[model samples]
Target chain A: LAKTTQPISMDSYEGQEVNITCSHNNIATNDYITWYQQFPSQGPRFIIQGYKTKVTNEVASLFIPADRKSSTLSLPRVSLSDTAVYYCLVGNSMDTGRRALTFGSGTRLQVQP
Target chain B: EAGVAQSPRYKIIEKRQSVAFWCNPISGHATLYWYQQILGQGPKLLIQFQNNGVVDDSQLPKDRFSAERLKGVDSTLKIQPAKLEDSAVYLCASSPRTSGGTYEQYFGPGTRLTVT
Candidate 1:
């Protein structure tokens, strides 16, 4: 499993777009970038995933450059409810039918009203 | 569809005491995972089960933590002689097996254990 590094915390205002980047300099060729969100007293929930380039979902967008060494998670029009800890994990989690996610400290995104 | 279910949502135990948490994964899900999340930290994988069989348990502190997914549906995780540092949230997640690289997993509310 490749290691990932992200901001410890970020501050944002409501309706503002937030982009959190993660650095995985040692990412492998087959590794995929995944992001998960967790609110207080809840388990982490899958947010978005991408192998390369850009993958946009209803909730967020993931942008991975050609080098695959780094990725960014973009949240549009954030709200207070969007305040949560976001984790960036790099691994081929779904390979072999096992989704073994290796989580880091995660970036705590605080959306202020 | 019912999501993964975990109980008793919260537990308080003294050091050296034992506690158990139960979880029910979504129907037909073949893989179940146990994770330990300490306060302010991301969750760490404790164990993984693939249809009643253990797939990985490298991080499990086998001396005190033990989990089982008998029948490959509902599962239980037990902590024997809990310690202060053992206080954390135990999360249960499940995902269906697939050939492609789809990283989707459903998570339960989790069991918060406080070992005093």
Candidate 2:
């Protein structure tokens, strides 16, 4: 498993586009970048995932460059309900050996109305 | 499809006491995981079960904590001699074994344990 670094906090106005980047300098070839969103008193939910290039889903988009050292999660048209803590994790293996994820202080996205 | 289900949304217990949390995974999910989420931190994997068998429990405190997934459908996680540091939310997640890496695991509401 590779360690990841991301911003501690970000502020954005509703309807604005927000891009949160995470750096995993030690990422391995098999490592995949995954982003999760967590609201207060709730379990984290998967937002998006990507191994390289760009991947888009209904909720968010994940961009991984050729180097794969860093990945960015892009959220379009933010709303008040989008305010939550975002976590970036790097891991491989379908089960990843059940490796406990060490979550750093996540980037708190505050969507202002 | 039903998501992972957990019981006793909130629990308050004194240190050294015992508490138990239950979880029912999504139908046909062969892989179930238990995680501990402390305040301001991400959920940490405490144990993982493949069906009714234990897969990994390296992070679990075996002396104080035990979990079982009997019948491969539902599971129970129990903590004896709880400590104040044990206060955290217990989250349950389940995923199909054949889903591969691209598939996402479903999470439950979680059991918030407060050991005072």
Candidate 3:
């Protein structure tokens, strides 16, 4: 498992675009970067995932550089409801027949009006 | 599709007492995971099971924590002689095994345990 580093907290205003970057300098070739969003009293939910380059979905977009050392999650048109803690995790597929995700202290995003 | 289900949304117990939590994963999912999330911290994987067989439990405190999944479906987690440090939310998640090895996990509303 590759250890990840991210900001502890970030502040944003409504209707703005927010980008949260995660650094995993020791990332492995087989590892993929995945992000999750967690609100108060709820379990984390999958937001987006990417191996390299850019991947976009209906909700968010994930951009991974060629080096794969760092990735960014871009949220468009942020709203107050977008406030939550975001987690960045790096792990390979279930090659060992099991999956164990190591989660670091996530970056808490506060979207204000 | 029904999502993961957990019981006893909240529990409060004193130190040295015993407690138990239950989880029902999404239908037809083959992998289940148990995680512990303390206040102000990200969730930590405690155990993982594949169709009733233990795949990894390296992080679980076997001396006081035990989990079982019977018939490869429903599961239960038990803690004996709990301590204050054990106060945390117990999360149950399930994922379908895919050939690509990229299975998205679905988590249930966790069981909040407060060891007072």
iRMSD, all candidates = 2.6, 2.4, 2.2
Against the true structure, whose TM-score is highest? 3
For candidate 3, lDDT tens digit of each residue in B1-116?
A: 78899999999999999999999999999989999999999999888899999988989999999999999999999999899999999999998886654557789999999999
Whole-model lDDT, candidate 3? Answer: 0.91
Tens digits of lDDT, candidate 1, B1-116: 99999999999999999999999999999989999999988889899888999988888899999999989999999999799999999999998876555557789999999998
Q: Mind giving the per-residue lDDT tens digits that candidate 1 earns over A31-90?
A: 888899999988889899999999999999999999999999999999999999999988
Clashing pairs in 2: none
Candidates sorted by DockQ, best first: 3, 1, 2
TM-scores, all candidates, are 0.96, 0.94, 0.97
- Off by more than 4 A, model 1: A94-99
lDDT of 2 at B2: 78
The sequence of per-residue lDDT tens digits that candidate 3 reaches over residues A7-107 is 99999999999999999999877778899999999999999988889999999999999999999999999999999999998886564322338889999
Q: Specify the poorest-scoring 10-residue window by lDDT in model 2 chain A.
A: A93-102
Global lDDT of each candidate: 0.90, 0.88, 0.91
Ranking by TM-score: 3, 1, 2
Greater TM-score among 1 and 2 belongs to 1
Candidate 3's docking class is medium
DockQ of each candidate, alpha-carbon based: 0.58, 0.57, 0.60
Q: Pick the winner on DockQ between candidates 1 and 3.
A: 3
